[model samples]
Target: MRSLTESDIRTSFVNCSKGEAQRLSVPRDLGQLPWADLDFLGWRDPGAPDRSCLVAEWRGGLLGVTLRFPPSRRGLRHRSMCSLCLTTHPGGGVSLMTARKAGAAGREGNSVGLYLCTDLACSLYVRGRKVPESGGRLEESLTLDQQIARTTGHLSAFLDKLYA
Candidate 1:
């Protein structure tokens, strides 16, 4: 991944109107981001909690998506999972990430919430940021290579849909 600018981020959006893309907030320190370590760049708008965005390169072109996160029920138990890494968390380190639909139809429809790792570090997880318990062993159900592939696949699919 390469560092991006606000212009790069906005231009990456394929689904949204040009006006919408121009208005969306882009990260200020895109140049400083650890691009090699990021499968995608995801961030919430500081001015609008319900609004968020993600940017990545897929298939040869840059892609980006706008998202919305509806407020959750307070005090309700969460079977938390990270959407980016698909990792389950017992009670902590998880968040709901929802993609806003493109066009008017999306605005009138309900948003979708995806459980995502709170830290939002899918790259780190894929690269073995830390042992996933069980004495630093990979899960028996999945080989280490499979895990990395799955993570990157998920990210690529998300970007594809955004640009499609």
Candidate 2:
């Protein structure tokens, strides 16, 4: 994925209001981020632990999504797989994240949910840059390119649900 500017990150959210997007925080070390290595950028809000964000280059433009999860990660320790990258986290490192649907459906409280990495780092996990404390790994039959494709497809499907 290409590196993104603050404006690109803030204005790309399709499911949030302009004010909400403006109030959301962007990563401080944009310049230092490993952009070329990521399929998408994702992070949990430091100030608001329950809030998270994901940004990716979609179609011909940038697509950002705001996500929310339960505040307490208590008792989530077991072998589970991230829906986005299919990586198994032995410490129950997955969180069920929900994205509010775009437009009126969102206004009416509709949302889509999926299990994802608690830290929102599916890209890093898939590429082996980051791993759970227990050390995560996928089956050998899947190549790195195949893993990338699955992760990208999962994210794209999630985005599609947001606008659908």
Per-candidate Cα lDDT values, in order, are 0.66, 0.85
Error of 2 at 18 (Å): 0.8
RMSD values for the candidates in order, in angstroms, are 4.1, 1.5
lDDT tens digits by residue: candidate 1, 35-140: 8777778787777776777777777877777766665553435455566676655444456776655556455663344666544666666666643322232354
lDDT of 1 at 63: 76
What's the CA error at residue 152 for candidate 1, in Å? 1.5
- Give lDDT for model 1: 0.66
For all predicted structures, in order, the TM-scores are: 0.72, 0.93
92-157: candidate 2 lDDT, tens digit per residue: 477788999989999999999999888877888888898776776765688889889988998899
TM-score of 1: 0.72
Who wins the TM-score comparison?
A: 2
